[model samples]
Target: MAVAWYRARLVESRPQTPTARTLVLRAPGWPGHLPGQHVDVRLTADDGYQAVRSYSLAAPTDGDRIELGVQSVPDGEVSPYLAEDLPAGAEVEVRGPLGNWFVWRPGGTDPVLLVAGGAGIVPLTAMVRARGEAGSPAPFHLLYSVRGPDSLWYRDHLAEDTPGLDVRIVYTRTAPPGTSRPPGRVTAADIPGVPAGRVYVCGPTDFVEAVDDLLIDLGRDPATIRTERFG
Candidate 1:
């Protein structure tokens, strides 16, 4: 598919978690996108040097605004700009809704297991929202691993009161005070006991690889696993 550039204006920007922010943009003529699609944003410096970065849309596919959840990476190029500098009404150029096979819609009959590490939850969150809104028949499960409770994105939205979803949180770095589990990384043991049909994993390269290995060991079919690796 051809990529088209949209001159989008920031409509709203707010923190979703301690380290991440959700940016909502309005592109007047922007063609709507799929749940797992991403957009490449370009920013120029004062000297005319430019940096480009890709961010997944966090909002459901049918929303009027496009939302992105960006985690602030220390000294990272585009993240710091979007987190600290970009503001409402700022004009930015972006291209896409790209990628073909990775997109996830809500209509499937098979169960879905979504595993996300750190800010990798962005795209999967969109899938969850879409499925919930559509009253999809597919059962959904989420395994979201973060550094600590403070860094867990969509904390409010993932509560048990939310319908049609099963969510589990794994705090790798710091667990709540008085918790028994050691404060560390997510291990194969942390995975919940759920029958896997289709699984989607997203996170840093090492994280995704580790989870993929664990899923394989747990008897999940390798062909049924889909992954997206970030730096």
Candidate 2:
């Protein structure tokens, strides 16, 4: 079957952080996707100019709706519109549910370790939501590095208990009040006691590369890790 572009209607939108928003889109007849999949969204301007960007699904596949977390990039062609301007009931052209290497399914029993930097949490959050929705018993750990507590997306959702989910946050620029960890970049020492498992890391190109090298130096097999860079 030939691939096709589909129309996605914005059903809901909410703040994920000060600079980002999560949009829930309704697409009928949409085939479901595995966690970590992304969609290419296309927007057309009044003068016929168009821009396209790929955003990962942030929630577990339910049936007809999918959630996307978009961060507004300064002077960006597409991100600013999606993150801060798009309104509910508007329609956007989308293609995909693309990618395979970075996806996770409920069948795996290995411990799931997720590492995120900034907006990269989009896909990792999907895996977290998937694990809970499927009632999968696999142990899950997330080491999320962000600028500060205020920049974190899905802060409330992440804080909610979903059995077997463990999270540790690292502050890069500033830490919250009464915090024990000083604001600093995530180093090799910040990793939780996660056993050898399927590790997924997502972030900017440089961040992903550094984490990949760090994981390798820590004695992790390169083959066991999957990564996606989205800067």
Return the top candidate by TM-score. Answer: 2
- lDDT of all the models against the reference? 0.84, 0.89
Q: Any runs in candidate 1 off by more than 4 Å, and if so which?
A: 178-180
Q: What is the TM-score of each candidate against the true structure?
A: 0.93, 0.96
lDDT of 2 by residue, 86-161 (tens): 8889999888778988999888889988999999999999999889888888999999999988899888869998
Q: After superposition, how far is residue 120 of candidate 1 from its true place, in Å?
A: 0.6
Span of ten consecutive residues with least summed lDDT in model 1: 155-164
Clashing pairs in 2: none
In angstroms, how far off is 78's CA in candidate 1?
1.7
Off by over 4 Å in 2: none
Backbone clashes in candidate 2 total 0
